[model samples]
Target: MVLLLLVSLPINIIFHKVKLPSVMGFIVAGVVIGPYGLKLVDDVESVNHLAEIGVILLLFVVGLEFSISRLIKNFIPLLAAGGAQLTFTGLAIYGILSYYGVPQNQSILLSALGAISSTAIVMKMITDRAELETLHGQTCIGILLVQDLAVVPLILMIPLLAGTAEGGSSSVGMAFLISVVAVTALVVVSRLLVPKALSWVARYGSSEHLTLLVILIILGAGLASESLGLSLAMGAFIAGIIISDSEYSHQIFLDILPLRDYFSAIFFISIGMLLNLSIFIESGTLIFTLLAALVVVKIAGAFLSAVVTKNSSRISFVVGLRLAQAGEFSLVLAKIALDEGIFEASQYQIFLIVSTLSMLIAPLLIQGSSKWSLRLFGAGDETAEGPKKSSGSLKDHVIVVGYGHGGQNLSKVLNEIQIPFQIIELDGESVRRALIENFKVLYGDSTRANILVQAGIMRAKAIVFAISDFQATEQGIKLSRKLNPDIHILVRTRFAREVEELTNAGADQVIAEEFETSIEIFSRVLREFKIPSNVIEQQIELVRMEGYGMFRGISLDAENLRKFSTYLTATLTESYQVSGECWANGKTVEALHLKALSGAQLIAVVRGNEVTADPDAAFSVVAGDVLVLFGRHASLVKARKIIEIGDGACEKS
Candidate 1:
């Protein structure tokens, strides 16, 4: 165990720095320490046992992340794209395996494995690049979600395919039905009971006991599923989904993450231990041949499936490459086949080699998709090429730099308002999409003056640099200024610190998303006090005027800090509309004297379209009058109580 950890930690960290998945690093460490390699570990049995627990735990976490609600919400994509992708990919692989004279069961297993992609890897890349909400990213995720759901049934089919005593037709049928019932009961019970139980534990149990409770739930679910003749990992997944629906899911995920990552390393390494250098040496040709075949099959399968679902040819091709890699679950499936005596040592080694190679290269494929899409589908031009054509026909258009999330949203708004705009984007896919949507998008780096001029920089009403890359945005700002000094320049940056830097770079209006987002949070916090929208807007403007410099290096002294806090938490003025059925509806203002009882000052009585400010003692409370009351939170509650149920609900008011 020490040797495994010692080897894995450094290797994983180093590979992670080099932009490769840590799973690869752990697998490499395993290969180096295995008996066939360095003989550091004579046997990997104990690690595999630990690795199995990791699988169940991580799958449980995955289950928590993906609930049935999320699945059903994406049902359209699941049925249309996901279902098609699986069926076509499986058919393509099954046909090839059968042609190569593979056994029926083995071909079926391999085909299913070939059809799935690594959800973790793809999602990480998408999120890191901030593209999870993009059409391509959303489509990929929807399909991946469905593919993950498909794993449950694949595992269920394992015993049936293996033809064990439990795999008899009637027995398998009964087991399947029972497993479905068990899963339903588990989800229902979890929703109805897990939260209450956890709340009870939280109230009485120590932190350690709470941790033990979570582990027990995970393990208990696994045991239950296994007892019902289903996959323990799948049972754990169901348990995870139950917790996910509960309020405790987030805490449980945070608690289990460290254990999950450590054991998951061991899981990947177990697969790596299967890498026989001997097989590579003797059957190098055949192994690479199989590797090439695996990539081709998956890429083609994804592409064909996407095409059948009416995804554009360009999107289908790129999406196909993104999903070319075999997943971690594929190894799990392969392991089951190996343990079931369905695959010979040589066959398992070939699948293992192919799977690893695919995973290692999948990241690169996703990262380089823009360039590949350009070359493969001719959807866009190289960045060196400026605008495909002159935009002389359009006058005073908005020029958007970088067609990422910010640019996309800005362009969408502009297009909706019938504002003339042209986009300068370096990403081939973004350019293709823009053009497809009938926008005047140029394929070039905006930092280039020539590219900017070609995009009508001189005549554009405004130039917006909306990309996340700071250096690139700075360059674009400087270049735009040098060319058209009087142009309206708006720059969007990620960090609060970038606000001053971007402003110095000559932006007319600089929006720091981080601080602006903070403003939003503070605004919401303020609104909870019933502070008016106009006040919130004023506070947000104040933050912007100061460049939200507090986030950078600006500091408030103790007195001023207290003053600001007081303003933020000051007495709020709220208006309560008088209802006809209320006991205080027709009472005299002197009798109700709310200021004396609830410490709430009636600032105004807005009756219909007229306002009577500071009503005197002779005034009568009437229905249809909006009493604008001003007070601290506690006083406001009393004022509301006096108004809601009359003076009877309040101690004095």
Candidate 2:
């Protein structure tokens, strides 16, 4: 295992750096180290044992991410796209096999194996592209779920198809019943016991206990499934689904991810080890012929399914290509069939080569399929639901990079004040969110020059790099400057050290998170000390000047600067709503004397969205009134606490 890691890690990393999928690298490493090449690991028994556990864990993680609620909600695609994809793909293969004089039972089994698409590959592609929320992406996931469920039936049919199991149809039905019962039991146990157990264990805050418990549950469920004469992976998936909505799901994911990735590499490598180079070399022409046929059939089936399901021709084509590959389950089924003497050794070897090669090339195909489809289909727009964009006349617009928190706030204020602005967000989901808010957001990498141009960077008044990724920010700043040298380039960096680098990259102002955070901290301290506003302003300006002139373009006196800086400080004029039953509700302003009690002066009382500025001391503080108060952090907390106290409850106590 250690030696396998030694070869696999560096190779995968190298492959990833070259824009190739890491799985391919692991497979290559496995092929080189396996008996056929170096004889380092003569047999795959130990690796396959570990590999099975890896597959279980991998599927478990995937199940955790895929909520059952999501599956139910997306049932249309599950039934429509999934049924079409599987039926059409299977029929095509089965027909071809029958034409070649293959037996009915073997042909049916082979067609079933060929029809299943790789959930791992397609899911990874969608995740990497940040497109899980897209129409096509969701469709793919729903169909994949149906197909995964179909695997149980397919596996059951294997023994029956081979005529080796007793009781025939009854035995098959029994296998499915056991699987369903085991899964239900696992879910019930998880929903009832796991969350309670996790909560109890979490209170102690022991990482060791939390991690151990998670591992125990994963393995326990897997073993239980196997004991019930079902696949271990099936049980682990059920366990993951049960824990997905638990409070500790995120933590459990964090705890188990590294192991999943590592073992996943081993799993793929073990797959590669199954290949015999001599056989593949002898059957290269035949192997390529079958691979091409498989690819064409899978793509056509998926595309037709998606099209019939009302997905755009372009989207359907892209999705078709995305899933045009034999999945890991297909390999598992083929191997099982070979072991049961349902497949000849030569036939199994051919299937292995086809499956491996299909998976190897799937990522690359998915990457380029959109562009390929757009060219072939000549669809008017790339996205069916994306926002309509016409940036031809965009000018003097503020360009905000990243649609995250800071960017959202900036864009919100810009919209409220009627300032024209455009957002550049790489995440398709984020872009969709921004579009929902009516922001003119484009979905593409801001680091790309063309994408920036699409955002009207050349004609924009200023560009704000609000994203946390420093490298991408720096590259964007450089490119933006080259495009519009006079455009005000403002950058936000997480570190003070990067400020100078950002300035060098052509950013006019660089606000480092650490530096600005310190300013906020000290300014609050000064406010608490009742330091003169002028002195604090000078201090902040001096620091900013020394740290790369971050707070620029604002020429303000102490008072105006103080007002602006208050927005950044913890002590500010913030509003607190007085709910019914609160102690302060129905009380007179003089009776409460909020300024005296909490050191928070209520400047305005807003009732039913009507603001009474500087209401008299006798003004009644009624429930549903929003009190805009000004005070330090501690005073605000105290004021909020008083407002939240039930009417007369405190006095009665």
Candidate 3:
């Protein structure tokens, strides 16, 4: 493991720096370390299992992030483009294979494989390029999502098809029925049982417990599908959809990230292991032919799909070219077909060769799409009409930089409140959607001065830097301040240290999400201990005030530090409050022998508005006084009974 990491890590780092997909590095690493090369990975089966895990996790995460509502909203375009692409590509490939004299069954299997593009590779590339939220990105992702949804049925049908005699009936009636029934059962169980089960586990308030529950749900669902002779990926995808709306979704994603990365790496490495260099070297002509066929079929299908969606020729070409690659899932399909005896060994080899080459050339095709689109169309031409210019002054309008989740939410609230605003988004799809909704949105990057001006930033009352990229946020702040020195800039960030930088760049307020979340978690912990509401509020206020902007640098005085320490101690105790009826209630500290309560320490007595700190032995306890005690969790629970519900020694009043 150490050796593999040592060899692959540097390559990955270099690839990332150069802005190339890391999958390329993984492939190269695997090829170099495999038996045919340096012979580092001798255990082929272990490596293959690791790779399979990677594919599973990759699909699992995709399912988790799938937005069904968004997909349904754009259903017409997605279905139209996706269906056209798949049909045309499949038919084109099938015809070509037949012309080349390939067997009927093998040709059909190849066609199905060709009909799909790599969701894993394409998504990674789009995300790395920061284009997943862009117009082309959205269109590509939407189409790919439809394809993924289709793969589940394809996997099931492959086995049935393989079992049919040559030239016999190709009836898929039974498979379809079973599939529908399975889907219905999954939906019912997920809707009725999964949420309640998850809620019960979540009440424990343990991160570990939540993580375990999430994994169990995913794996359980996956195994259930497998036991019914269906694809595990289908089950995993369904599981993702079920949990996507849960509060723990993001946390679950974070928890499973390590597993995803590890498995994905193995998946790529396994692909590398499968490649036979000698086969390629000996059949150069065949390899090129297969590669050319795959590319042409994919591009043709994508282009036709784009046209059907009402896109212009230029837009269609760009979309087609961007999607002209066989993705990771294609390989999964090929493997399944091969295992089911749907394709001969030689045919499977050809498909793998074609798929890998397509992936290798995908980056080049995508990189040139923008420039090519402009050349095909006209420079500076908006496919849809540009936003209409305002007839009156643009002053007092809010300038929103980014139309993502946070930006969209803010815009919705602003609209409800009747606030005029101009939104600037770099993504084409987001801009397109906004335009369709008749929103005052500009398609451009806010970091650029010209784009900001186009969005009426100069006359804006406040600039909301809602973009997640920190460097981009800083740039926007600097540009906005330079253009309008008096404008208020509100920036959102994930780190506290970014506040100072943003403020220095002329931001009026910087909201750090991580810091805010941490404070919220701390507050909840305090509340669980039954701390007085006012005390908790005061501590929170102090933390927020001291933690924001320049005040973060100043050290607290001794008195304030002591106070903070005391609050922290009280917050950590699980159950430190005792009811009035407890044996220790109305008993002086000396009389109760407070030292005997393991790990317990009395901090103060809250009697109405006055607080008694480190009280003397004569400090008599009042019935209504709330005792502030600190101790280990178990000790705190025992002490809580004395101050809260009271000990069993209480008599009826």
Which lDDT tens digits does candidate 2 get at residues 1-653?
Answer: 88898888898899889988776787888888887767789768899888877878877887677676665555665677888999999999999999999998899998999999887667756654545545567778777766776777788899888888665677655665665576667667767877787788888769889888888888888887677656677778777877888878888888888888888778878867866788889999999999999999999999999888766566688778988999888988998899888999888888988888888788788877765765565322325554234456789999999887789999999999999999987555567789899889887656556677778877899999987655457667877887789999888776666788888889888888766877898899987775545556767876675553435334556664575566456446668888887888888888776777678788898999588998898899988899988877656656776777732333442
Off by over 4 Å in 1: 101-109, 116-185, 206-208, 228-230, 307-318, 327-342, 366-653
RMSD of 1: 9.8
lDDT by residue for model 1 (382-492), tens:
356653445466678899987876888999999999999989886555777788888889876665566787888878889998876555567678778877898999988
TM-score of each: 0.60, 0.63, 0.62
Query: How many angstroms is residue 315 displaced in model 1 relative to the true structure, after the best TM-score fit?
Result: 4.9
Can you write out model 3's per-residue Cα lDDT over 39-128, one digit (the tens) per residue?
Answer: 888888887766656666766676566554665567677767777888888899999989989778777767877888877666656654
**lDDT values of the candidates?**
0.75, 0.77, 0.71
Query: Where does the lowest 10-residue lDDT sum fall in candidate 3?
Result: 644-653
* TM-score of structure candidate 1: 0.60
Q: Order of candidates by TM-score, top first?
A: 2, 3, 1
Off by over 4 Å in 3: 1-3, 67-80, 98-105, 123-141, 152-163, 166-170, 173-181, 204-206, 310-322, 332-344, 361-379, 382-404, 412-419, 422-653
Model 2 per-residue lDDT at 37 = 65
